[model samples]
Target chain A: MKTLLMTISRDLKVAYRNPADVINPLVFFVIVISLFPLGISPSADVLVGIAPGVIWVAALLSCLLSFELMFRSDYEDGSLEQMTFGSGPFILVIMGKIVSHWIMTGLPLALLSPLLGMMLFVPPPGLTALMLSLLLATPTLSLLGSVGAGLTVGLRKGGVLVAILVLPLFVPVLILATAMVQTGIQGGDYTGHMLWLGALLAIATGISPLATSAAVRISLSH
Target chain B: MLNVRNLTCIRDERVLFENLSFSLGAGEALRVEGSNGTGKTTLLRILAGLYEDYEGEVDWALDEFPLYVGHKPGVKDLLTATENLTWLSALQEGQVAPDAVRAALAQVNLRGFEDVSCGSMSEGQRKRVNLARLYLTRASAWILDEPFSAIDVSGIAALEERMNDHVLAGGLLLLITHQQLQLDCAVRSLRLGV
Candidate 1:
């Protein structure tokens, strides 16, 4: 646990030191949300109807953009190799990375979703639930995206390939996340959606890191 | 403290090397000399436990883990030298003291540059920062691929001194270097043919 915390803290420090990396994804999120307003009618009803999908998609893409840098930079610089040889299990190291990525990308997206949600004319009651759903959902995206990022870490053009590999896996997440928001919007009890989201988070937290570590080992091989 | 028996490495439908066997104990080093196309780095990777595709068994009795420094320095370009070292230390063991990082950097002649971002440093300077880990960690085995390539004369001499000290202190060193490396300790040479 100590090692995990230290790794996460270090990653956070690195992410913080480079403000542009953090700002770029946030900008992407805002820009993507703005496009929907221009592309569709400005009617509050239509915008509110589609806001859930738009926010989820933007969040997914933003997470994907940051995922590639997670292990690729470490792998290229030999830090990943050292971690593999270190006393800690490689999976644990990957988990720490996933968690740090969530704190860096997912947490911010969740916090910013409320403002974006307001812009999309989502009902005030639904806005809180939308933020909650994003809070639970984006971390799962980071974890799942990590597996794809690890698999493609060493490839020359792995950026878009990572998106291609991960988006299919994200379909279920997209379905459940938007459903949760849509449920809240429709004045339905969101407990079931929240429960399902929690289950997905649990499954992702349990399985993704181990799979990512294995994929990373394979990718690092010449 | 290290033993390998009949190591065979095959990649891309071609046998890079076959039936290779060697061992290194305390006070000894292995210099894997080979032609350009030969798999010196690949062999080093297999020995370092990073690549398991090769057919071989590497047995080590050392308490501490082996440190593998590849061609790339592996320092994050965006991170300062101190930050990189601290993070690497945490990943390997736990939190390392600031003094230890400072001492290691000074050993590699990077005293004042510890706060500088690695991206702005010269290639040789960056290599020195990477090599500083050897001084910081108590790893018993060091597997370095081409440690001297692209380094200046002073850097090479400093690295050779560190390698000698490591061997003298009962640590093992395995290096792949084309440049002539002069050391006080006995070195076992394994030359590969194209």
Candidate 2:
């Protein structure tokens, strides 16, 4: 637990020191959302209809943007090597990283959903579903993205490759999270949609760190 | 103690080294010498358990785990020197007191640079920060790759002295370096790509 917490504190410390890293994805999230209403239509009916899909997609992309550097610096500077060879199970440090990644990118984005939902003209119920769905889905995003990031840590233009690898996996979450908001907008029960997202999260949390460790071991092999 | 038998590594379909074997007991130092791209770093990674695609039997018996420092210093640019050491040592499950960390920094001639961000330090100073970790490590074996490549004469001498002390204290080390380490202990040299 100490190793896990130290990794969390260290990852967050590094992220906190770099202002651009913390702010860029968030700015991207807001900019993408604001541009949707302008590019498509200013009509509230159209905006409200497309808002959940647009918001969820934007959040996924922003999370991916931050995920690119999750293991890059550590790999480049040999921290990953040391972390792998360290005393305790290195998998725990990886688990710590996933948590910190969520705290940095996922938590803030979820907090901002209310404001983003307002701009999208989403109703109160939809906004509630939006926040809850984001809260559930972002952990999965961070987890799945970590696997992609670990696989492409050494590749040139790895960010694009990670997106390509992870987007397919994200499809189910997108479908289910957007379905939650849509159901809420129509005053229908959305509990089923959330349960689906929760199941995805549970599976993702169980498997991603181990897959990432294997991918990292592959990349480390000469 | 560290033992390796019949280790062969092939990288990118090219054989870097094969039929390699060596061992080091407590308080002994083995210096791995090789040309660039000759798998000096690869050999260290394999021993460190970071690489798995090798034909070998590595039987290592020790109390604390091995501390592996590679070509890179593993220091984060945004973190200060003290923060980096604290966390790095924490990886070993050794909570060296703050005063002890300060003393380690002083031992490495980095006394006044603890609070400074590692990004702003000179190359030698950065190397010094990594060497300071030596004072904080509690591992039974040290696996260092190219530990003497980018440092000053005095820094190298300090490092050699530390190695001698470690050996005299019955620690084990497997180091890779082109520069000869003059230590007053049992020294073994192994060349790769033969």
TM-score of 1: 0.95
Regions of model 2 farther than 4 Å from truth: none
Question: Which model scores highest in lDDT?
Answer: 2
Cα lDDT, model 2, residue B89: 81
Q: Worst lDDT window (10 residues) for model 2 chain A?
A: A78-87
lDDT of 2 by residue, B64-121 (tens): 7788778788888889999888888878754668898899889989878999999999
| lDDT tens digits, residue span A90-194, model 2 | 788899999999999999999999999999899998899899999989999999999999999977689899999999999999999999999988878999998
* Per-residue lDDT over B166-186 for candidate 1, one digit per residue giving the tens place of the 0 to 100 score: 999888889999898899998
Q: All predictions: root-mean-square deviation over Cα?
A: 1.7, 1.3
lDDT of every model, 2 decimals? 0.86, 0.87
Clashes of each: 2, 0
